[model samples]
Target: MQGKAGNAYLINELVRLVYLTYHVQDAGYGDTDVVVYARAEAALERCLQRAEREQVWRLEPDDAPMFEAILRQAGRQPA
Candidate 1:
């Protein structure tokens, strides 16, 4: 999984996978950017909430820069 995000292209692939599997439509990559934006934001928020509740960084720094990077790759900014 770490290797899967070593570069920009890989990150794009990861996002594409998420968008496709979860049916997250693309903005410029499709007809409507608004729909994709809403769905993708919802998906990302769910993931973040889950991570927080699960204490996903117990043994780590808790900064979660990795997840942040993933968000950046998906064309989303961190909160």
Candidate 2:
């Protein structure tokens, strides 16, 4: 995992999980399944943290906006 392919894979994984979280909330399961929602949120947080720690955005300027958008969705300030 180095270079554009790695960046793309990480971004895709983040996007997939974010959409899954959104789907859970949109389906009203977030209210009924606290544990599930919490787990999803936790996973997203961990992914976001990893992206930030790796400086993924900075590594690939072309992918920066996408990473920033994901960060914002996770209520994190993009670095």
Candidate 3:
């Protein structure tokens, strides 16, 4: 039960990460305020780190390039 709950939490984090990435990308491209963009970027970075720490899933090959691009744009190294 505990393991299942942990898995569920990780899954939620993954979903959050996906949404954060999209928000960050949109904020970056749009005329959004810098503070808003920075906040979204920071959230995305935190999510990325959390997902990497879980080590339960890897980005698909098709997704890797875009993910890396986002990290680079955020001035972070792809982990």
> TM-score for all predictions?
0.32, 0.34, 0.33
Backbone clash total for model 3 is 0
lDDT of each: 0.41, 0.49, 0.46
Deviation (Å) of 76 in candidate 2: 30
**lDDT tens digits by residue: candidate 1, 1-79:** 2312233354345456455533433323323334444555454454445446763312123324444444444554221
Those runs of model 3 whose alpha carbons end farther than 4 Å from true positions after fitting are 1-6, 29-79
Q: Order the candidate numbers by TM-score, best to worst.
A: 2, 3, 1
Q: Where's the lowest-lDDT run of ten residues in candidate 3?
A: 1-10
Q: In model 3, how large is the Cα lDDT of residue 60? A: 32
Error of 3 at 64 (Å): 8.1
What TM-score does model 1 achieve against the real structure?
Answer: 0.32
Error of 1 at 32 (Å): 3.8
Candidate 1 at residue 56, lDDT?
34
Name the TM-score of candidate 2: 0.34
